[model samples]
Target: MDIEIIAIGGYEEAGRNMTAVRCGRDIVIFDMGLRLDQTTLNEDADIVGMQVADLVKIKAIPDDSVLKANDGTVKAIVCSHGHIDHIGAIPMLAQRYNAPIIATPYTTELIRQQMAGDTKAGDAAKLMALKAGQRYTLSQNLILEFVRTQHSIIDAVTPVLHTPEGAIVYALDFKLDRTPVIGEPPDVARLRQIGKEGVLALIVECTNVGKKGRCPSERIARDLVRDTITTYEDDKNAIIVSTFSSHVSRIKTIAECAHEIGRKPVLLGRSMEKYATIAEQMKLVSFPETTSAFGNRRTIDRTLRRIMKGGKDQFLPIVTGHQGEPGSVLTRIATGDTPYQLMQGDKVIFSANIIPTPLNFGQRHLIEARMQLVGARVFEDLHVSGHAYREDHYEFIQFLQPEHVIPAHGGMTMTAEYILFAGEMGYTPHATAHLMKNGQRVKIR
Candidate 1:
């Protein structure tokens, strides 16, 4: 059987993910996602309806034309995780293909939420809740396995699509966290078995493969939070923290710290409320009873009044805008777009790294410059990545030993560095590495 992979939007950059795998005439879709920055401007319909492109140049919402070209050959659609960069394009793409999407339970919830929240209703989705070890048959030719993985969000998995020829493992955006609180460890046993079974091709995420060492654990991140917050966190002032809203584990850690320090935690912003509700319903995370969630302007106004009057130290607010998105809750609070006024000497903790994009770089710096002017103390980089570093990736290659390898999730420089890790192993230059860009296709036998 001949296999062809189209490197869709996310291949060239960090977001707007789309990928296609063709075997003979049968095709399997890996993910369909959107660029967060681009999607921020798009309304609900713009987000979930149509094959959105050409108008939103910054976004590439999967290569739907390629999927259609399969002519009903799509056997299944598998989303690796819940990050918008991985599943954001699903509602748009799933409408065109009548395929059952396979993902873990938490990821399933996210997909459903995204669909339900979208004006399109994402009703086109046909979802299958997959556990880490469950095996499902996509077609006679493709038997698929879901191998659990660790990431910022829970229920991340590396999919192993088993074909008659061999297995192709799609390992994207995973960190090998032995101590992940939400799920079992990475299915290392299955990975070892796949290694023994002989993997045909392994598509690995190159998001952080350029970094040489293994990523620090979430526990380290907790310690960083402890150090940053205790040292700079104003127990005497209202504390504001910002982070990736989808990151439930990180949120749990911060919540724990807030409780330990006797700050009443308040979750702000839309995403913060959404994921936390899902996580609580799923029992993946739980916050202390003292924590409160606020969304509406009027509610937040009342809460801030109580906080301002009672004492700045009375409540700790967790809001979005880690990348300095202009109108996000934290940004509005910082700039006074919202009713909440910041007292001088108040502290803002950024439990995130400024995603290194030109747009994000400028926006975040501008926000920080403004914060500095307002005399707000800011603590940043007190976070850990959810992706494996180069050394961790080396271990992944050593484990899978696939006949072909493709770096699927980074720019040219990062992608090349990702593929080079495989080259360092025994595989030849041509036999091993394929660093593909968006719109490019790689054929495998």
Candidate 2:
């Protein structure tokens, strides 16, 4: 039986990361993600109720029509992490596949929540929770293994497919974080063992390949947030922070710092409440006792009013909209649409980087300008990237030492750069190091 690698999505751009590894008659798919940069929608846009065809037309979700054309059965739909770019399309697309959706425990909960919100898809797809360092048999020829890895979010893993030929590793959205704030470091010994055992094909992300060094640890982000927030510990002005709601470690850090500085950490916005609350509920993370969360516009606005009435110095509002997404808490507050007023010298801290899209940059710029006009002091880049960088990729490639390489989870330029980098390591393009685009397929003997 021959093996084939299919680039269903994410080969064209940074988001919507879906890939299929076909082994004879059975196929294992990794990530049915959504593209976050839909021009028609804002960063916080909701496509939950949207049809699969409409979302595909707008490039908001992966066009899995190509999968329908294949003859093989989809044995499993595996998600690497809980990020929207990894599992956002599940609610709309997973229903089409008559297979179990396998993910780490936290990611499984996230997917369950997403499916619960979309009744049309929820009842059709089965959900399976597979923890890291565990294995599940998909078929006689395919055994799936979850290898622990670090990223911006908790419970992220690098999935490996064990087949008769060799092992196929899916290393999208991972980082070699030796000192993560929340979990143990990447399973280095297990990865090295897998490398020694023999890897047939390695599909990896090239999102941060252009960056020169290894990605910084989440510990550094904690330091940056702590140093920044504690500097104004004595200040009486409002301190509003915005970050990726899914980043549980960063939220914990921000909340701890707020508690340390005698301020209650009030999580606002729907997503802010969802991700953090779920993480807390699972015992995956614990925030300060002073931390509170509010979702929905009415409750959020009411909470903001309470903050305003209770005095700004007493609370730190950790909100959404670091990308200045329309309708997010930070955006609403910045535009004076919320009851929480921003006074002169009030702080707005961004614990995330702009996700390198025209829409994100423009929205971020507009909201920053608006906040500055109100005399709010803005702090930026109090965060670290979750994707591995150039050296980290090099290290990963060295560890796996796979016979074939497929550069994925990036557009033309980023993927091409990985190919070039692989060339220096003696990987011939198309022969060993393959650069693929969305909807393309390559066969490996």
Best by lDDT: 2
Tens-place lDDT per residue, model 1, 305-407, is 7877887787788887898887677777877776577766878889988888778888788878777787888888989999998888888877887888888
Error of 1 at 293 (Å): 1.8
Instruction: Mark the regions of model 1 whose C-alpha exceeds 4 Å error after superposition.
Output: 38-58, 68-72, 121-125, 230-234
lDDT of 2 by residue, 1-445 (tens): 7899989989988888899988998999999998877644543566766778888888878888887645599999999999998999999888788899999999999998888877777663489999999999999999999999999889999999999999999998899999999999999899989999999999999989999998999999999999999986459898999999989899999999999989999999888899999999999999998899998999999999998899999999999999988888999999999988887999999999988888889999999999999899999999999999999999998899999999998889999999999998889998999999888889997
RMSD to native, candidate 2: 1.2
Count of clashes in candidate 1:
1
Best-fitting candidate, measured by TM-score? 2
TM-scores of all candidate predictions against the true structure: 0.93, 0.98
